[model samples]
Structures are given as C-alpha cells and as structure tokens.
Target: MANMNTLAPHVSGSTFGQVIIDTIADLRDRRAQRAVYRRVYNELSAMGPRELADIGISRNNIAEIAKQSAYGL
Candidate 1:
C-alpha cells in the first residue's frame, strides 16, 4: 500500500474540519451584510415623500439608493 501520511498530508493543511469552519464563517458574514441592507431599506421606505426630499432622496430614487447602499456605487 502507499504511505498513509503522503496520501492524506497534514490534517491542519487541508481537511473537512477546516472547510466546515470556513464555510460557516462565510455564511455568517453574508447573513450580517444582508441584515444591515434590510434594516437600511426599511428605514428609508418608512420615510414620507416630504421627509425623504429633505435628505435629497425621492421615491423614484429609493430603489437605486438601496442598491448602492448595499453594494456601493
């Protein structure tokens, strides 16, 4: 049989355990970004037309603004 160590390498270098941890961390970051985007959109949507105008945002611009806010220009 081939050498077991050469076949598997070190557990720390490339293993299912590290992959799972990285996947979970990535998922959590995505979830947090989505939550922030939702909160900002809701807050802006709650504003009346007049209130929004005071800040230079009109109803027509809400969608664009939300998109930019979520992911930059």
Candidate 2:
C-alpha cells in the first residue's frame, strides 16, 4: 500500500545515512593513526646515528618501527 512504500524509503535512507557516518569515522581514525606514525618517524629520524645505535634502532628501520608503534603491526 501507500504507507508501506513510504516506510521502506525511510528505512533505506536511515541505512544510507549510517553508512556515511561510519565512513567518516573510519577516515578519522586512519588520519589519526597516520599522524602518530609521522610523529614517531620524524622524532626518530632527527636523532644522530650514535643515539639511534644506543637504542638498538638502525636508521633503515625507522619507518618500520614507527609503523609498528602507530598501527601495532
């Protein structure tokens, strides 16, 4: 009937809205993780070779270390 047709559209609209909200939330989380990765990488890169060696981190591994620290991978 007419009422059923109207109700179906409303439900579909609500689901679409939820999908948009979820996408935005996912994007925000990814941006935050990327910021953390960049910060850690920059700080490590600024250290001298001797300082890095003191901490057992080679310059070549800075990106991997930062990724692990940020994304827990």
Candidate 3:
C-alpha cells in the first residue's frame, strides 16, 4: 500500500487561500499596469505632432512606449 503523505500546515488550505490572495494581487497589478499604459498613450496622443517629434517618439510607437513606461521591461 502506498503511504499517504499529509501536506504541512503551511501547504494546507491556509496556503491555498494565500495563493488565491497572491493571484488576486498579481491581477490587480496587471490591471494597474494596463491603466498606466492607457493613460500614457492618451496623454501622448493628445500632444501636437510637433511636440511628439521633439520628444523623438513617433506616433506609431505610442503603444510600445506606454507598455515600457508601465512595466519598465
């Protein structure tokens, strides 16, 4: 017969609950990151073309720039 091993106290439902909480936190972080991206994009897009040109960021690269601004990766 195979021995049934019990999970340690830390690995039990308490841990499961913590994992769920961690997942929620991670999701919130991602949501906030996306929000940052959107906000940056909108703000940048509102600038006149000459202003954007002065900054050297093209209109096409706004999304990528926003993502980088949000995540730094």
Candidate 4:
C-alpha cells in the first residue's frame, strides 16, 4: 500500500489559498448531500404508515434509506 504520510506537501511548497479553497469545496459537497437526504427524509416522513409499508419502507428505516439514497448507493 502507498504511504499517504509521504504524500503530504512540504510547507515551503504549500499554498494556504489552495487549502482554503479545497476545504470550501468539500463543505459545499457535504451541504448538498445533506440537503438531498433531508428532502427524502421529509417526503418519507409525510407518508402514512400504510403507504410506506406498501413501498417496503418502514418509519424506522427512513434514516438509513435517506443516507443511502443521498449518496447514490
């Protein structure tokens, strides 16, 4: 396996601006994923118990399903 520690950029060659940009990009991606999950969860929660059961989804399974659907699993 490759050693990731050795891949770290040296301080002399690193750019703080790039690091900040990367962090912001990651945060945006995470926010988008959470938004999708929340939407799915809300839709599922709005369904009646019988309706959810007909679709093979239970109230107890909403969280797991939301996560899997959000991440395209």
Candidate 5:
C-alpha cells in the first residue's frame, strides 16, 4: 500500500513564504526606482537649453540620463 504522504508531491512551507516575501520586495524596489526616474526626468526637463548645457546634459538625452540614474543601466 502506498502512503498518502509519499504519493503526493512535497511542498515546502518556507519556500512558498520566501517567494511571497521576495515578490513584495521586488515590487517595492521597482516603485522606488520609478520615483527616482520621474524626479530626475522632471527636474531635467524644467531646465532651458543654456542651463542644461552648463550641466553638460542635452535635452534630447534627459530620459536616458534619468533611466541610468534610477536603474544604473
């Protein structure tokens, strides 16, 4: 006779719990990064051509710079 516990696949309680924790952490991190990106983009966009040039950033590259600042990529 097969034991019921042996017949069923084993599922670990800790693994499941860890997965939930990791997911929540990942979501929180993304949200924070998004906030950083938005702030950088908005601040850069508000500057005029001369101001941007003084800082060595071009208006056309504002979005890319914000992305790099927030995501490091």
Candidate 6:
C-alpha cells in the first residue's frame, strides 16, 4: 500500500486549515469593501445636484465616483 502520509496532503505545507482561513479572510475583505462603497454612495446621493456639481460630480456619476473612492482606482 502507498505511504499513509503521502496518501493525504501534508497539512504542514499545503494546509487545509490555511485554505479555510484564506477563504474567510477574502470574504471579510469583500464585505468591508462593499460597506465602504455603500457608505460613500449614500453620502454622495444625499447631496443636492447643485452640491454635487459644485464638487465636480454629477448625480449620474455617484456610483462610479463611489467605486473609485472605495477602490482607489
């Protein structure tokens, strides 16, 4: 029979536990980014057209602007 240790992946190198942890951390990061996007969108949307234009953003661009603000791109 094959070696039992080699039959299953060595957790020390390619850890199943680490994969779970990475997945959870990725989910949390995505959630936090969404929250930030929502907050900026709401704050911008709350402003009047005149207010938005004065800041050089139009109402139609609120979503794009919020995304740029949250993602810095």
In order, what lDDT does every prediction score?
0.77, 0.88, 0.86, 0.86, 0.87, 0.84
What local lDDT does model 4 show for residue 43? 98
Give the TM-score comparing model 6 with the true structure, all chains together. Answer: 0.77
* TM-score of predicted structure 4: 0.76
Query: Would you estimate the TM-scores of all the predictions?
Result: 0.69, 0.79, 0.75, 0.76, 0.78, 0.77
Model 6 scores a C-alpha lDDT of 0.84
Candidate that scores best on TM-score: 2
Sequence-dependent TM-score of model 3: 0.75
Q: Decide which is better by lDDT, 1 or 3.
A: 3
The order by descending TM-score is 2, 5, 6, 4, 3, 1
Q: Tens-digit lDDT track for model 1 on 14-69? A: 77677778778978987877777787788999999889989998888777777777
Cα lDDT tens digits for candidate 2, 1-73: 3545443353454775676687789899999999999999999999999999999999999999999999999
Q: How accurate is candidate 1 locally (lDDT)?
A: 0.77
lDDT of 5 at 47: 96
Model 4: per-residue Cα lDDT at residue 13: 61
Best by lDDT: 2
Query: Which residue segments of model 5 deviate by more than 4 Å?
Result: 1-14
Error of 3 at 59 (Å): 0.5
Q: Summarize candidate 3's per-residue lDDT along 1-73 as a digit string, tens digits.
A: 9974353344455676677787789899999999999999999999989999999989999989998999997
What is the alpha-carbon RMSD of candidate 4 to the true structure? 5.7
The residue-by-residue lDDT of candidate 6 on 1-73, one tens digit each, is 6755553354556576686787789789989988999999999999998898899988999999889978877
Report residue 62 deviation for candidate 2 (angstroms): 0.2
- How does model 1 score by TM-score? 0.69
> Which ranges of candidate 2 are over 4 A from the true structure?
1-14
Q: Any runs in candidate 6 off by more than 4 Å, and if so which?
A: 1-13
